[model samples]
Every structure is written in structure tokens, then in C-alpha cells.
Target: MPSTPSIPPWDVHRPPPGHGKVFLITGGNAGIGYFIAEQLSAAGATVVLGSRNPAKAEAATASIRARVPGAQVRTVRLDLADLPSLRTAVEPLGAERLDGVIHNAGVALDDPPREETREGHELMFATNHLGHFALTHWLMPLLSAAPAARVVTVGSFAAKTERLDPDDLQSRKEYVPKRAYGRSKLAQMYFGLELDRRLRAAGSAVASVVVHPGGALDSLTPSRPPVHVRTAGARLRGAPAALLVQGKDAGAWPAVRAVLDPDVRGGELWGPRVFGLRGRPRRERVWTHLTDASAATRLWDASRDLTGVDPGRLP
Candidate 1:
């Protein structure tokens, strides 16, 4: 085993021309995802936006076109909640060689006790991990088609404080809004590392990288609370307070860096360098336990069972 290499913060680098690369990003309609797509398109990459809402996706594309004046950006329908939709959503995209795939779609809320998706897995786990798992499994051929392709999965710092309960993955025994979210994020990071290992073992051309945003306050954060209570709470907290929240552009930097940085290696985790909370991107070591071979294998098996998608069958 060798020591992991570290990368400097985002401000240390300049955006290089993307030239003829093709990039795809999930949840590109808003927030961090949209910002990433904007930056990539501005860099000259052919960008494809994947979202559950076609209307919102169209609007996002329009906004990008307005900014870049003929930016090559398009949209595809993808709903992480529905496994069947995942298959249908990506079919029309055609099997073109891809330079990168940014797995950024996610959902978080204080909902009722553990709800399962049509795939029979916890909702958050299904969307945050299994959905991306299935997508990556299907896209391996396209990813491998490129001489050098990268798969960047958006993770979170919360994964550091959470642990996966193999027996209670659905949280049937106990459930908490924050815990569920954290666990799903933990799964995301683990999956990225494991996928990289498998790719290396098979001598594939794809490299897998994981990144976290620290905490970039977004519209999604405010939507967590009930509408009426959320309003009153905002009033008590002081109006316009949330307006000072961290910008999504800063949050998206790490993902962009992981995807496009020439020095980035497989299994490298990128996040803020300051307080691991908010700042520019930097390559940092994930918690030691996250790379534990046993746990990674366990997670890989669980994800395969849950999603019914096996990486071995992929190209």
C-alpha cells in the first residue's frame, strides 16, 4: 500500500480548454450541478444535462445558452427514484465515447420512516447510491470507449460521521433525517473507491474519483422544513439571512477539479481545504476506515443485490 497524494486548493489552478471532450452530469438543472455544467460548457466541452424535470432542464439549458451564446448543452430525462426510468432515460442519449460522468443527482428531506423505492431499497440509498450505480454500470462501455475517462461522484463530509448498518440499510429499525442522508453519502464515497479498484483490476480505461461540497447552502436546504414552520423559522432566524449562504459555484469547484484536473488519480477524494467545511477544492485523504477493504467489499455486494446491476456485466 502507498500513501495517497494531496492536491492544492481550487484557486491554485486555471481552467484548461476542454476542446473535444464530451461530459454528462446528473441533476444539472440547478444548484451545484447547474454550476458545474455552466463551467464545463464555458470551457468548450459538449455538456449534457440529466434531470427528472424536462421543463426545468430546458430552462437550465436556455440559461446556459444565454450565458455562453451557443454553448453546446443538451438535456436528458432521468428520475433517480425510478429504476425503470433510469433505463429509459439514458437509452436515447446514444452510445458515444464519454470523457466524464458527474454523478450529482440527490435528494434529502425529513420524511416519514423508511420508504422503499420500486427497487425495494431505502429511498435515499436508492437515489444517492443505487441509482448512480445502475447508471454507471450501464455507461461503462461508453466510458471505456474513451482513452482516458473519469467518473466523478459527488459525496459529502457527513459521510465521515456516519456508519452503514448492513442489516438495517432501509432504516426499518430506526430512522433519522440526517443519519439516513449521511449513510447514503458514505455509500457513495465507498462505491467510488471500490469501482476504481475494480476498474484497475480489469485494466479498464476509466478512473473513478469522489468529491464533497462541504456545505454549500442551497434552495434544497431550505426545502427540508415544512412550509409553514419553515417560514416562521426563517422569520425568527432573521429574513435575508439565508441570502448570505455560500455560493453554489464554490461548491461545484471540487467536482469540476476532480473531473478535469490532469493530475487527479483514481480513488482521490477532493473537498474544501479550510475546516473541511467551506472553501476551495483540495485533494485530501478520506477517513482511513472508508478504504477498509472488508467494508468496501460488503458495500459493493449490497449495492449489487439492491440494484440488480453487476459491474462484471458492463464493458
Candidate 2:
């Protein structure tokens, strides 16, 4: 394992002005994704808020504009669970050049019985890892075209406790919801790191960085009318529990760091500076599984085979 130095403190509110940059954030309709989009658009970036539902995305965009007057925000329908939905969702971005893309959409957890995506992969794996993989391949050129573009993937602390069975990448033999979720997150981090290495080797200016939002809860978010989030969320966030957990906006700091921090290098993994669950962004190491070069390569190859799309054209 290579040693990595700790990162400096990051203030998510202090992102550099993004007047000329164009950013795309998947799952921007709610949760940390929405907050990230809010912060980015407030910073003056022309942000493409990608969501599975057009109405929800529009609602989020309106909320952003209401909060940050004159913000440049557009909605794009992106469904990570469906490949066809991804294609239709990405059509609008074909002509708009992007300076950065954040793969932030994913299923946090699900009950057992391991469901399969439309593409016939494990549901968690398909949404959390493969969807981002295929999306990246689709946008590689536009990314490479921009000078020093970045790809920031939102990973999770679940990676630390999980083990990936490379042989059964799809969880066919066994399936536990949390374990499956953790494996998917680990795969995301692995893919991001491997992409960084590949882009660097190819002498491409694009950088791939992965980050995890600490224990962020939806309860901390202000109510978005018409959508009833788990009401229990607000209760769970009460009293001392609130201190340990971070709000959705604060949880987005690591990803915000990955997106805007100029000093951040490719292949770096960043998360909360305090206990890996709260505070400003700090550099961290993921499980050795994510650092295993061979495993990453296998995942990358498998991704291309499944998606039938090659990201090789970028370099």
C-alpha cells in the first residue's frame, strides 16, 4: 500500500468562483446531491442537475434558484438504474461542454433478495458502480475537451467494512443488503482510482477523484414541500443524535472538496476529517481491495463488456 499524507482543512462554503465552468451532478434532486448542486450553482457554475424524474429535478432547480437568485441551473433526467433512461437523460448534454462531472446518484441501501437492474446486474452494483462507469465513458470526450476537467465520484464509509468477491461480482451466490451496498461503494472507489491512473498514463488532463459524505441524514434538510421524506428522520436527528450526524449540506463537503479544491490530485480518496463521519474534508485511504490494481482492471474491463462502450477513445 502506498502511503498518503493527510489533507488540509476544507471549507465547503469557500469554493472558488465557477463563473465559466459547467458542472453536471447526478441525483441532484435531493439529499447530498441537491445540496451539492445548490452550493455549486451558488458558486456561479452552470450546473446540470440530473435526476430520474423531471418534475423532481425541476423542483430542486427551482429551490436552488429561490435560494440563490440568478443561479444558472438546468434539469436533465438521469436514471442510474436503467440504461435506456441514462441514454435519454444524457441527450441534452450532448452539445453543452462540461468542466466537471460528479457521479453522486446511488441507492444507499435496500432490503435483501438481491434485485437485478434492467441490464441484468445486481441492483446495488448496477446503480452505485456500473451506472457511473457507463456514464463516464459516455462523457469522457467532453470532459477531456475541457482543460483539466475532473470526475468526482461520491463513495461511502461502507467501503471500509465490506469485502468484494471478485469472482461473484454480481452477488449471485449470496446477498445481504448492507454488504452488497458496501461492495458497490468499494467498487466505485476502485474504479475512480483506476481511472485516475489510466488518464495520467495517457497524459490526459482529466482527473478522477473519489470522496465520501460522512453520516449525512435527510432529516437535517429543510422540508421540500409535496415530498414527505421519512418523518422519522426529523426525530432521529433530534437531541444529541444531531451533534453526531451531519446535515446533507455539510455531508457534501468532501465531494465539494473533490469538485473545487485546486490542490486535490487525481486518485485521491477524501472524506470527513473527524471520525470519517463529520467535519471538513480530509484525505483518507480506502480498503486495500480498492487499491488492488488487478481488481480494478478486472472491474473496468467487465464494465466495458457489460455496457458495450469503450472509454478508450479519450486518451
lDDT winner? 2
Alpha carbon lDDT at 274, candidate 2: 84
Deviation in Å, model 2, residue 276 alpha carbon: 0.9
Q: Write candidate 1's Cα lDDT for 4-100 as tens digits.
A: 8985444523677787898889999887898889888888888999998998888888878877766999988888888767766777776478899
Clash count, one per candidate: 0, 0
In order, candidate lDDTs are 0.81, 0.82
lDDT, model 1, position 148: 93
TM-score between model 2 and native: 0.91
What's the lDDT of the predicted structure labeled candidate 2? Answer: 0.82
* CA shift of 48, model 2, Å: 0.4
Tens-digit lDDT track of model 2 for 2-120: 87988655557778788888899999888889888989988888899888889888888888888899999998878788865665566788545678999999895668677887678
Worst 10 residues of 1 by lDDT: 220-229
Error of 2 at 225 (Å): 4.0
